[model samples]
Structure formats: structure tokens, C-alpha cells
Target: MIVCHCNSISDRDILSAVEWMRAADPQTIITPGKVYHALGKRPECGGCLSLFIGTMEKSDSLGVPAVLQNLRPRRGRFAGK
Candidate 1:
């Protein structure tokens, strides 16, 4: 299934890129731009962003690594400082 017509990217391409990125760096955050870069392509019209993201979301390797998650300080950490 074609996800980005401008880049000629297929669902498989996105999935493969995601898997490869995850394997290369488990802590790296995966995004459309990163996927495009991995595939050696770039977005043109920006029309396929939603679908591109949808395809990426389907990959199990797309999730942020557990170690990298929840790094932001929670609310009220500096209240009334």
C-alpha cells in the first residue's frame, strides 16, 4: 500500500525503516522525517502525512523506548518556587 505518493513510499518501506531505526538505536525517537531520511526520500506535498503516520503507527517498533519515556518533569514539581 502506498503511503506517500510524492516519495513513492510504501507501507512496507515505512515499517522496514521503523524496524531498522529501532534496531539501530533503541532510544531514538521515530518520526516521519526520520523515516523519510532512512528511506532516502523527503515529503513533497505534505498530503500524505496522516497516512504516513498511520502506517508508521502500525509498526510495533515505533513505540518510544521504555528507558527514554517519562523524562519530562511532572506538574507541580516547581510550584510556588
Candidate 2:
């Protein structure tokens, strides 16, 4: 299941990278670029983005951490504290 032909990245590779990253930092946002970096590779033509993203979405570890969820600015108006 090759995801990125240019970088020789496979589905398993992406999953492993995601798992590793999640294990390393539960709060880190998982992205294609970060997965590529984790696998020691980089995107070439950006053609595999759709499939790459698709594969990433399948991973259970790929989700925003609870601590980072619903973090919206409360009203704004903090003029120098």
C-alpha cells in the first residue's frame, strides 16, 4: 500500500510514524509533513497529498490531544496585564 511513490512511503510506514509521534508527544498535531519528517523523507511533486492524507486519517493515533481541544480565545480585551 504505497502512499507516496516519490518518497517511497507506504501506508504501514505512515502508521508507524504516526504511532511513534503520538507516543513521543501525545499533544503534537499529526500532519503529512511531520510524518514525512518522521520517516526521514520529503514530498516531491505533492501529487500524493490526497492519498497521503487519506492514509493518515485512518490511524487511530492521529487526532488532536484533549488538552488542545476547544481552545478558543475568551473574548479578547486583554490590554496589557
**Per-residue lDDT of 1-81 in model 1, one digit per residue for the tens?**
888888789999999999999999999999999999999997899999999999999999999899987777667866444
| TM-score against truth, every candidate | 0.87, 0.87
**Model 2: number of backbone collisions:** 0
| TM-score of candidate 2 versus the correct structure, residues matched by position | 0.87
* Top candidate when judged by TM-score against the true structure: 1
Off by over 4 Å in 1: 76-81
lDDT of 2 by residue, 1-81 (tens): 988898888999999999999999999999889999999897899999999999999999998999997677555585332
* Global lDDT of each candidate: 0.91, 0.90
Weakest lDDT window of 10 consecutive positions for candidate 2: 72-81
